[model samples]
Target: MNSNTFSTLNRDLLLNQLEEETFDILVIGGGITGSGIALDAITRGLKVALVERYDFASGTSSRSGKLIHGGLKYLQNFDIPVVKETGRERDIVYKNARHLVYPIKMNFPIIKKESYNLVTLKAGLTLYDRLAGVKKEERHTIYGKKNTLENEPLFNSKLVQGSGVYVEYRTDDSRLTMEVAKTAAEKGATILNYAEMTDFLKDANNQVKGIVVKDHIDNKTITIRAKHIVNAAGPWVDKVREKDRPVTGKYMVLAKGIHIVFDYHSLPVNSSIYFQHKGRMIAVIPVGNRTYVGSTESLYTENMDNIMVNKSEVEYLLGCLHDMFPTLNLNIHDVISSWAGIRPLIGEDGKSPSELSRHDEIFESDTGLITIAGGKLTGYRKMAERILQYIEKKEKKAITPSKTDHIKLSGAQFNSAEDITSLTTLLHGRYIELNLAEEEIYQYVLRYGSNTEKLLQTISEYNAKDLNLEERNILAELAYTIDNEMVASLSDFYDRRTSYLLFDLDKVKRSLEIITSEMSTILRWDNKKREEENRAMQYLIKRTLSFKD
Candidate 1:
């Protein structure tokens, strides 16, 4: 697991991996499921290559509600098996990525007296706890209205006649996506973020073999050869499948889900809330210092890359939140940050998109390309296992069964929570030693777990001039982005490395100068190019970030 194995996702390496070497498998998307496939294949000693048209997790993966639990709502559909499997998988993910995923208790408030009676809510919670394996310490619990208010008084107390039972886990979806990609790269997988699969290359027999790819940064197209190809393109699965000859299987049933991040207190509740909104379930998940109010389910029609939030989606989500928590004064103007992600659902007749199954479907196109469609972030590892099983049976290779359940992700390798705490302490020491503040160390621990040690070492040699940023984000991180992480653009820093724009959009405009200057030094951007990058990030910030007028 030498760090050198991970390299910048630049044009040279992408072209080299594609044209110079024969690959056993090529995964055509860089999201969670695709990253999982790459990790699974490479761990089995298969030569693997993965390419993304945009940044990794730039689509639905990053835009998820960031939960790592079984779909409780799916229970309403009577899909008990899905809930159980996802519960088991959720435990596996919690164990495998302990640093990122953590347990959170959720409360389902029964607003309508007769709509969902206490008996039914209690039954559902009991089933949820059982599906989660009901560890003695983490079993589901119920509370009377008084006890519920005692636990989470911020909840809309007046409207709450009775609230139901509690259970579930919350997570940072973007960080999880990045960590999976990082783990795959550590395990001998070739991963490229800004590389895209343009079309497939077939032999005389018309068996799909490889791909023609374009490096978006350099605008150079190259051919890559592989024995097997996997299409895990998420929302774009339909578009990517168009390249496969005569299109063997139906690709996607696109359902759009939008979430809005509000200022933490305006809608603060200690426990996450899930209630009926227009006959559908919407969750109000509380993460650190913020509340994730989301997820309006609607049919979406547009290219995913260019999809932006219309006024209606924002209004729909806000209205739902208002209905559940009438006391919490919130409107579209209260939206701090908003995003939309398309769930790649299995297509079904006689049903609206929201009613489409969250279950994943695997199809081998007539030309032998495998397209994995549907499923959600919670069940990614399971999805990977399914994909690997298909490849194992098709190739007839005697490979090790999927071991990711046992394999710890990069950040989860700490021997104990104490080790993580010690690393955090070490980061603080280094920051103080470098005359930096304690609060600044948070970002370092977040981006790189123990890997921050390397960043500190690199920064120790630089002077104050090289170690300052416009927003005062430590220069060490920006240097690490250039040296270690393949941060080729400003969006990488603002959107991914730190959620600066999402959290503090106004400061971003003022912070642009320092970031551009440092990035220009590292990325070799000229004055014009640096300005262009700044302008693009500004446009994205204006589009995505919630602002205080």
Candidate 2:
């Protein structure tokens, strides 16, 4: 970990820095959008500070389908500019954080005499590859019925004419956000999570100047001064905007997206599937020992913050799965975990939830409140770049161009893709004494990239430590995350940091006691605080067990 790493251990110190310095830019959200903006600002020579009500990516960013593709629906609607930009930007995301964002092949099946026949499917993919400026080697491959069946037997073959295999990037959305936040902090941005911005501080002319925030760690009120402020709060964008003034002209419309996870023994997927069942596009992606499928989109108004998947959503998704893979017959009981998030899409009159566009918008209020809302995971860097560009023009400052396009994130060590495989081989042999399985080591490599070596070296230096492989791995991850990743609580580590609460639940339960003990020691929690942390983890775990329709 870097000596100046942002973590719970330095909450007071970072808050002191925030209170003392009046930054050039103070961002009001710690999700990917705000994090990206902070990174761009700091790297381009602007003093920056970011505040999130909860942990970074604890909101919408953490609950996505976790893909880095411009929506195929966007291409179907002829959004060439957006598709082109995101296709280009995804490469940048991969180059910077290959461990978090990497290539995966997706199966999109064609139907006879339906919405997409073979000819239309092939033509659409051709245009899609062209719009994306895809390399010839990575372009779409049309698969015949026999090849399609051989590739994915889970999909229903009754109406399937053929399939198109195309390249799409998969990502750990929360991890990507955390790495971006860390990179921003590395470049001199004072990033604070679990810090809530309570109110806006306005100057004499009613133009924004600073903000009043409540620090959750210590229960203290702190005033942070800044020249410019941006509201990149995802689901709460409108609420934050209304705090500045009455939200007018271009309000927000939110939709709920729900996903369910199943163990590989119950239902397995060899590769990712982009299946359209009854006009909705659902992605069924397999990650090692488990297969997860989603998402059901429905218009949502209430329950904005604590969004949960409902029983109906679960049934609907299971029905969707049956539509594609009839034999699976997965029920709610088969679902190990479920997550739902509100997509803060830009509203249009009479538009249904699925019909609404996914394009992001910037609304600069009359009092100088800049609100950024409605964007996909893959386009976060560009969104941040645009926000910084807006500030540069408004403030008339000599701003430098963005360097994040090529900048490696906090844990990215390799210069190229092939370097990752070589890294795994070397680290496996080097850290064999740890007694962790080779598969587990590779997972660690994927999770932390070059930082895994640092974690192992730190662990190796400890003498007379009594811990098993699981406990030792948990302790190592907790140490690295706290020292380097700005983790604030047990849920942050369990839920977002490693995604253990959802995919790897048994590991979380197995490590919970050790996790709390270490967290208490690291954060200096008393008996009551320790109990509260445990209770919070329980509440979060319970939240993932149900869906809200």
Write down the lDDT of every candidate, Cα atoms only: 0.75, 0.85
Runs in model 1 deviating more than 4 A are: 1-3, 9-11, 113-115, 348-355, 397-400, 436-443, 458-463, 466-472, 545-549
Per residue, candidate 2 scores C-alpha lDDT tens digits across 1-549 of 235647677787898999999999999998999999999988888899999999999989999998998446677778888888988888889889988887899999875545777778898889888887787888999998989988988778886778999989999999999889989998899999989999999989999999999999899999999999999998798889888888766778888888899998788877888877767788988888888898888888877766767888889888888878888877888899878887788875566656666789887998898999999899999999889888888878675567789889988977777788788888889878877666776788799988888777766654248876667767878887887787879989998889999898878888899899999998889999999999989888888885555
Q: Give candidate 2 misplaced runs (Cα > 4 Å).
A: 348-357, 397-401, 461-463
Best TM-score goes to which candidate?
2
Q: Candidate 2: minimum summed lDDT over ten consecutive residues — where?
A: 455-464
TM-scores of all candidate predictions against the true structure: 0.92, 0.96
**Candidate achieving the largest lDDT:** 2
RMSD of candidates 1 onward, in order: 2.9, 2.0
360-478 in candidate 1: lDDT tens per residue? 88888778888998888988887888898888889796645688888888767665556677777777875675665554555456556667677777666564453354333445566
